[model samples]
Target: MLILGGTGDATVLAVRASEIPGVDVITALAGRTRQPTVLSENTRIGGFGGVAGLTNYLREQQIDLLIDATHPFAAQISFNAAAAAATTGILHLMLIRPAWNPTTGDRWIDVESNQAAATVLPGLAQRIFLTIGRQELAPFAHLQAPSLDTRNKSLLASQAIDLWFLIRMIDPPPPDVAIPPGKILLARGPFSLEEERSLLQQYEIGAIVSKNSGGDATYAKIRAARELMIPVVMIQRPSVPSGEQVETLETAVAWIRKQLAIRA
Candidate 1:
């Protein structure tokens, strides 16, 4: 079985799948992070080029089942996996955690994309906590104070905002990319509510910007925002290729076992 992995659920699924008798599991990581959590003994890192490359890899590996246990926002890989499975005549399943729905006291301003979130920031609070991943930081860079140049004064003046961001990520962003003026917190998630609340209070965060990548590992900040009555600018997940999907890990494991049993 070939499992496309990165998220916490993916890691757990990889470990569980490895224990099943006669099942040889190989997990693939996109290698976006500087240091990713080790999933299994048989793991491949980096991209497979594109759809063509992925289809070739699937054929060469003799993979029986393709389980897309990737991040919800990883639409490209999910789409490629579906296409590749169809081309190679293999079974494909998507194991995704359900998205977080708003409850009472939760203020969520949903947007289609990161660019839209950035565009709407000025109208919200000035002090923002940007929990969106490092790769998506470019859009919010415009919120930074304008550069001092006479020739570009008009453009700069138009783009200028009083907003200050607190960008948090597991790794530092790429060197060449420009970012908004704020402190960067480098840490991994599965954070406690106390820690999340303290961090928000310390930074005096007025609003939060995050992707709707649902799971418990990084959900403390969302709860903290709710408790603090802070509005969240949520960037919605991108559309992926349609397929059989399971919301829980157990269901995914059962589905895999059923497939393997049929083949056996």
Candidate 2:
């Protein structure tokens, strides 16, 4: 059995799966997170190359079942896995966490991409707390670079740099942003309100950027920003690729049990 791992729910499900006798489980992580949770059984870190590579691996490993338990934002890998499963004829199940709904007093600015958020940034405010993923950081390169008009005036105007981004992510982003050293903050979250408040205060943050990755792990920052009356540059969850999705562990367990019984 193969399970895509990293999500909190996925880890919980993996632990439960490890309990089943005679069922070998292999969980794959995206290798994005620094302090990832330990799986219930054998674990593998890093990418699968692509669909072709995964297809070949599936045949060689003779994997019987595939469980996609990756984060909601892990779209490309999820798509690749789906393609590999279809070709290899491996039984596949998706265990996706549900998305979050907006609550009262939440000032949300829904954006489609990192660039979109950047476009609105100048109007929103100068100081920003960016929390989009590591891989997604490259798109913000232009923001990191100074404008042509500003560069001609003086080095001090460049030095002043009204627009600032306080970026936070799990893994190291590709070296492309070229942002000033003082601007970046490499940290993981499940951030406490106190921590969030302190960070925002220290940075003098007027806005926050986050993806609506539904979970409790990184939501305290949003609440902290809210208390500080800072706006959140929110990106909604992307639609799931074509698949049968299971939300809760109960359903996933039942589904897996049925599959195992059928195999038996």
Q: Give per-residue CA lDDT, model 1, range 70-114, as digits (tens).
A: 999999999999999999988999998999888999999999998
Give lDDT: candidate 1, residue 178.
Answer: 78
Each prediction's RMSD over C-alphas, in Å, is 4.6, 4.5
Query: Which stretches of model 1 miss by more than 4 angstroms?
Result: 144-161
TM-score of candidate 2 on Cα atoms, chains taken together: 0.85
TM-score top scorer: 1
Work out the TM-score per prediction. Answer: 0.93, 0.85
Compared with the true structure, the alpha-carbon lDDT of candidate 1 equals 0.90
Q: Rate the local accuracy (lDDT) of all candidates.
A: 0.90, 0.79
Write the residue-wise lDDT of candidate 2 on 1-264 in tens digits: 888887888888888887888778888887777767767658888888999988998898899989998888888888999999999999989888777666777778998777777777666766678887666654555554333355465334353445677878766666664542336667765788899889999989888888888778888888887787888888877666787888888899888899999979
Worst lDDT run of 10 residues, candidate 2, spans 153-162
